[model samples]
Target: MKHLSPKQKASIALAALRGEKISKLSSDYQVHPNQIGKWKKLAEEELAVLFTDKRKKENHSQERIIDELYQTIGRREVEISWLKKNSSLSYPERLTLANKEHPDISTLRQAELLDISRSSIYYQPTVNPGDIQIMNSIDKIFTQCPFYGHRRIKPELKEEYGINIGKKRIISLMKEMGLNAIYPRPKLNLSSSDKQHKKFPYLLKGLPIIRPNQVWGTDITYIKLKKYFAYLVAILDWYSRYVVAWKLSPTLENIFCIQALEQALKINKTEVHNSDQGAQYTSLNYINILEESEIRISMDGRGRCMDNIFTERLWRTVKYENIYLNEYADIGEAGQGLSEYFKFYNEKRRHQSLDYKTPAQIYFAKY
Candidate 1:
């Protein structure tokens, strides 16, 4: 007999079901009546299964489409991560992609995965440059004495800078700039009030950092731009004084802190990650990242113990050498300027502490 497609066989089966004579149909199609009878009976027996199989095929197709979508998502994530590490894309641009809404992952977590900061995610170039001169004066004061709160800053602004800004305005601007007049003393302390959460004690008081990734320190500081101001968060390898990752944001949010952390972890997860008890470090999102990685969490006491001293020293270096010298025009210019600065800092600028060796040299060679 001739080969018949399922459709043709189904047509014949339907004909027989409609009371067509089995012998007549077989004779017309040039097939035996017995084969015709079997086809008809089999089709009748599994008619329901045919409908079921169509549904199954549709389900299979849907699953295939979903799989393709997942693969596409995965590819995009990889591309974004690569761009974050390798591209000329600014810090804020990298943060923008990584800091997005996700169902399972928090935006902060996404920022970390992309290796960008959360604060940078929403940074706008629009400058409200309240008082550029005043803010710069404030920057110098805060840089000199970070322990001075707004109340103390107001007096210095009047006495030293000859600006009589109110304390409230100073408070507001300091808050806007993410600069808190850290009480007690500056340069190695912050407060976290989580009594239930396990807080590690200050681990780098007098201990000598022997290698890269032995203890990683992170901190946030304000950056003075030409018109507007921005905040900078950086992670440093304490031993080598290497800036592992750094980001600048218009505000002081923890996501950028998380982003810096994420970038550093990508290179090498450190044994201990140290920071002040600022909201960012104390945040559940940030804590979880370190906790999950099995990294020891070290927090400076509220008093004076020099928790992240290496990172504090870096801020002085960055400001004195690069940030102050350039006076970046805007966030875009600032981003570009800082990028070049960090590159030079890591690759070119030799440190007196490291015997005139660059951070990259000590971080890569001896370790």
Candidate 2:
């Protein structure tokens, strides 16, 4: 009559399924043969569940049903609690005394008994008008020709939309919106060379990336909210196009970029890490992490775009698909939305460049 924990029970169940004799299992586990026999009997009666696919299928189905039921129960419980507190019935007697007279009692009772709700739920989000219009225009133009720089985009705005905006303003806006021209094109912004950090040559020029951890590229992109802006830095795998790690910050500081690099390194160490010669990337603190990890540092050639093409493509996809679709009201909303989009990008959305397979699929294909 000894009580067994779930782990002990699982051990017994697994041992019984492996066809080990009861006496042998008892001896090995330092328990009595009767205990082993009892465990075996219990295991045998439920053992089919361990091997049968239907058991897992049913469990998953039941879990989903249970989650939905719990949600419904929670909502009804809130309503019942509200009615009890607000109505004439005392809190303790509300369920019994107010059950018959209350109109919502029936629904609450149904939800409580069945573990489901009958109420409809809807969500309405507020959006900024100016941000919406700007995002819409950015989406349209970026989709048509991703290689068009802000110089070309600024003129297009005036000629096509009749909006007279300066190139500097458009460039600033483009950076804020995380829009960038495709790689191998002209550089939009110049990196600082005044820093004392050592710059490395691009080592991926002729290298064939056949494995996931062979090469990693990092870059920073701007994210625009309704009234403010944030910066996002991501380290991506060159071979699989998978984002290893990412970070968001209010300013284009070196700390946030370094934090992202540290997170990515913790997941998996890469043989070579590449980045543009931006000050943040070239800072001593940022470069030291790679040096400590023994990761080969690679920097894009001055004003060269093709050196970091993959990261550019990632920015383009994110901006067009998620960032430009809606005007985020704050940094929190932008972070949440971008996180969801990245999840979809990594796990669900298929990329043509990756043979129509998701980044997760390609990244784990070899394993």
Candidate 3:
């Protein structure tokens, strides 16, 4: 009738099992006779299970453990075999490992396991040998005629090299190479404009650039590399055609433009700094630097390349004199080649407009 320990219950049940009467055991243990009967019934039902054979169950448990161990060993073996096949291999070599002819693994599954794209497994890239020659010819054409758009370039391509091509394809290649006509055009893509940034007026329109520090103009141009293109930003002294500072970047980020500005300011401070309406020049950071230096900020009117006339001319001179002369393999190679070229440009190359005087001679005339 009251709470009883498991030991007490088991003892009562044992007495019942030993042929002792449940009513006598109940009276002896102070438990109800009905409670003793319930305990005895439970023990009798479970006693058979306690004495039954367990070897079969043990053997079954052992077999399951052995199966799991075998599965783990198989997984490790597959991993080891894969590593042995692909160890220390290059990406192209590893790509050859995915076989569509394999019986078990499909191409998709093999690609996923190899951490590569399924398309890459089957897609073979073929380069058109004529593209390089055509691009080089295009570069020469663009260098000679900066104002030629894709419409004009199409004919020039056919006339110059007999390489007849469509307008759309030429436009795509020009876009990729970052080339556009230098004439006053509606859309300029080299530098994009952000609607959020502040736009400034063109201040060099009537201003006389009499000396080295009177006005400095900056612009970005694309230099063709062996495989791709690189962007070059330069700050030029308008009056002397002296390159104050130049930076080459793989991107069109404002940081590189700002760095070029910083470098120019370090060399000599100009009274006015001019650039296109491109976002790189109008960016808050670029504006802040010019404002901080007390230099007047001037931006070309939208679609006006001549607003920064000296820099545009500088780009032409750079391409014809140096860029077109050398085949730069990479950015580093281009940088090195451009460094020497700019050195020659500033120190040795004489400008007919500058009375045959070099930029260094004019820039450092007073010094």
lDDT (10s digit) by residue, model 3, range 23-115: 334433446677788898999998878657877666667878799899879766765677677665433345557787766555644653554
Per-residue C-alpha lDDT of model 1 across residues 347-366, encoded as one tens digit per residue: 99888999999999999984
lDDT per residue as tens, model 2, 33-144: 6777777778787756656787567866887879999988987786767555546421112222323344544543432232212120011224456654665565467656
Which candidate tops TM-score? 1
TM-scores of all models? Answer: 0.66, 0.58, 0.62
lDDT of each: 0.72, 0.67, 0.75
- Model 3: CA > 4 A from native: 1-135
RMSD of each: 19.3, 19.0, 26.3
